[model samples]
Target: MRPQLRLLCDSSFRGPQRSRDVASILREVDELQAKEIVLVAQDLASYGKDRPDELGAGSIVDLVRQVSAKVPRTRLLYLYPSDLSDALIEAILDSGVPYFDLSLQHVSKPHLRRMRRWGDGERFLRRIADIRARAAQATFRSNFIVGYPGETEDDHDQLLSFVGEASLDWCGFFEYSPEEGTYALGLPDQVPVGLMHERIAELREMQDAITAAKRDELIDQTLEVLVDEPGIARSHHEAPQIDGIIRVPLTLPTGSFASVQIVDAQGPDLVAQGADSAS
Candidate 1:
């Protein structure tokens, strides 16, 4: 009824010095009466992998199991270090949280390397395949930055190809803005401002078509939606604010869950109704 709770998973939330007390955090969740949660692993796999013996695959597996057993309704906001280990992928699938919001900056490998990001477009597609094989209805979402320094025709084409191939259900493409003293500003072959706009426009058009097609596939499917506000509900596929929502006729209590039959998908948002009744 109240939507979800975004509880910090640990004290050093942004970086490596982890401190997560599962039971204590669950108590806070109960105090808040939150039915859903989002674990913000800003870049867990990256640092966690550095010392496998101490924070290895085993620890990740155990962590997933702990959270799944304790706070079963939580969703992970990210799975970073783009090339996910098999253990992490299996842990995620087993965790029952089917939504993924990857920080995949760009698809072009050269472009990605330039941006100081990990993973490439092809590897990401393979990861998607692996995830979808187990969780067919998984919602894949990601954000991309377009027109980085030194971006060329080939790089743009590579990203456009990824937009079509990634099968992302929801995505956002942002135009690159030069931040003062950022390393990106020092790179050569800076794209012209007008050309930068052109690249963003292309990515947008490509993703719109892909997102629309994917949403259309959800018609008539029964999904569990949490009523966050009056006449507004969100399924597992939908996140807060930035993502799409479901419009419902039922005046269900905010912060409660309901079984909804997806009636329509207009653009990114959806319209839903009670499974057994009309809207």
Candidate 2:
């Protein structure tokens, strides 16, 4: 697996020279045969904070086009967020980028605030709705933290509720792992490991149900799958090289797209049925 080189420069209103600078850098990469490129927007507003209105969506579309035109074989991953307003998420989807990475950590609002992460579950849901509205065929993914300090049974249950509501195309469930230097580490009445593990199991179970429903929902939906190497067919939720894949019945042609249908769900992987293939 090749490491994805990400350009994190905040595109907020820095002006034309900035755009040119970015263009120049991309132009250099145009000459080199890079494996993959991911443009990550750390925050919503910051992604397009700089530049003129004309530079808004067109600029991103142009940038991605430039890269692809330069290196015809390069794959681009646009990491946007549903945490932003629906309009913004829609704009991102309308930018002609085929991939989007959203976020959702611990469906419980209280736990989210406690973690000092994005709040507004309703808005998050709305943004997801917007994504589906704009591009029903788009590939989407999100994350969730299982346990948090002071997270009660009610909170965990609330999170479970959200799992069903979100119907995330891809879901990542992580057990709360505390870091000593962080504020969560200093918070009182930390959840016990045993309890945390219990909660993690519960959350995973809920996520499994939600994921199954999502997979089932897409059973008849046509999806353009990027074929993988022999014995490896990855899910939409899995990050490249970081997640395991479903075993495909037949070897698949690398880098080619094949139409597939969701047939089964296995933890993080969605076993897809396509024209005999594996990646």
Please list the C-alpha lDDT of all candidates, in the order they appear. 0.73, 0.57
Index of the highest-TM-score prediction:
1
Candidate that would win on lDDT: 1
Q: Can you tell me which runs of candidate 1 are displaced by over 4 Å?
A: 5-24, 46-61, 81-83, 274-279
CA shift of 250, model 1, Å: 2.9
lDDT of 1 by residue, 1-279 (tens): 363545333434334545344456556666665666666655544423544655543355555565666554667665564546677767767765678778888888888888888788888898888788878888888888888898889999998888888879888888888877678878888889899899899889888888787777888888888888778888878777768888876567777778878878888878875422233
User: Candidate 2 regions off by >4 Å?
Assistant: 1-21, 28-36, 40-98, 216-222, 230-239, 242-252, 259-279
TM-score of every prediction relative to native? 0.85, 0.68
Q: Alpha carbon lDDT of residue 124, candidate 2?
A: 71
Worst lDDT 10-window in candidate 1: 5-14
Q: Local error of candidate 1 at 83, Å?
A: 5.5
Please report, as a residue range, the 10-residue window in candidate 2 with the lowest summed lDDT.
11-20
